[model samples]
Target: MLSTNPFALSDTRAPLYFSDKVALVTGGASGIGMATAELLAREGARVVIADRCRDDGEELAARLRHEYGQALFVETDVGCASSVQALVGRTLLEYGRIDCAINNAGLSETPVDLIDASGEQWERLMAVNLRGVWLSMQHQIRAMLDAGRGAIVNVSSRTGLVGKPRLAIYTASKHGVLGLTRSAAIDYAPHGIRINAVCPGLIHTPFVEQKFGDGLPELARTMNPLGRIGRPEEVAECIAWLCSDAASFVVGVSLPVDGGAVA
Candidate 1:
């Protein structure tokens, strides 16, 4: 039902569909997470940015609060059960409820062939990308159940639905994210909680730079049918819509925000 271009952030006066909502975004210090946090705050949601990057987290929170006055940053390692618990507890204590959550804290390993991928590296990627989402969803769903309404957007990737060479661990972890999103949606939809995922193509963000470096620009331009990589804000828009009332009927779906890359 969201007819407006979900990839464009040009509509400045667009409605604050999330006004009064208390939203939380993990891995909110940079890339799509940060862009999503900024957009949510601009839409009048009180946002809690949870990330392990202390300085960037604080700086982003400060910038949002100074500009919008409804942003808070909490240092969190989503992979840790204790840290995740404290994150949910603190958010409730500070804001009284959690209306939405975006679990985006994830890392990619250096490219390695399937046979070359080490057990430790695979486990490490799983710990953060898969287990982290599981923990965050467990707590967020608990909070939302008490309040009787909520939405969750897991930051998945195009690689989740398609295999890519030399990225064994990362692809496996992302595929797990898709599985989690579907299962959680089925379990919580009756409870008024919606769970979905955004599988983005290459996007211009710090994370992409870390993963692909100078080659990313060229990669993005020619990677898909659209002939370009995506921007962080473009991915953020899809996430924002999935979190909004406009996407009320959308649930348990892995919507691809790719530039026709998976097609």
Candidate 2:
């Protein structure tokens, strides 16, 4: 097993579990993606931050470089096959192989009942949230298959497990992610690839701010058993562990990083 000491990562000498590993995180410009990228880089992974947010992506890559880690920023539209292909190509051109990948590029739509939701809304969300993951894994898995080892973490949502009013399209997209994760996990596990999904609840992110804003306080209190929204880093921690040797035995689990909401 590719193991590292289980000490808290804050310790400077904590074994660099991901040292020399090449990690690619899509949607890495902000939110959970950003947190995961930062954690992976801090732990000694050469990271590629792929996102449409060019400024944030560039700035983050620069910061990691300054911290003495190798990082690259690629502006990508995950929904585009050509774009995602170019992303993997660029990563391989620079680093030679892909050791880990997190398909986190997703967007949410304003709440709308399924009946009232327009086809345009559904297509747009599915493009990024579902097809994007599918496109990414097709390429990522091929790279890992050649390398003989890899890990993939797909970000879903609590709604993927259950249902919520006025968010049917988003729910479908997330649920699709879990389906992709599990089936691929089963297919590739014997090939030395571990695939899993993280279903996060209401998290405190820029997306959340845009979605809930001033009502966040009230929203947090009623949303989950923990009575508070989750931090992006909390989900990032779960993702990192899943990507590590610590979780070598884990596969195809749609772990709820939510505050016991699905319970």
| Winning candidate number (lDDT) | 2
Give all candidates' CA lDDT scores: 0.91, 0.93
> Which prediction has the highest TM-score against the true structure?
2
Q: Candidate 1, residues 50-139: lDDT per residue as tens digits? A: 999999999999999998778899999898999999999999999999999999999877888789878899889998999999999999
Candidate 2 Cα RMSD after full superposition onto the native fold (Å): 2.5
lDDT of 1 at 224: 94
lDDT of 2 by residue, 1-263 (tens): 33254425653375377889999999999999999999899888999999999999999999999984699999999999999999999999999999999999999879987889998998999999999999999999999999999999999999889988898999999999999999999999999999999999988998889877899999899988899999998998899899998899999999999899899
TM-score of each: 0.94, 0.96
Question: What lDDT does candidate 2 reach at residue 58?
Answer: 99
* Error in Å for residue 73 of model 2: 0.4
What is the Cα-based TM-score of model 1?
Answer: 0.94
lDDT of 1 at 172: 88
Q: What's the lDDT for residue 106 in model 1?
A: 93
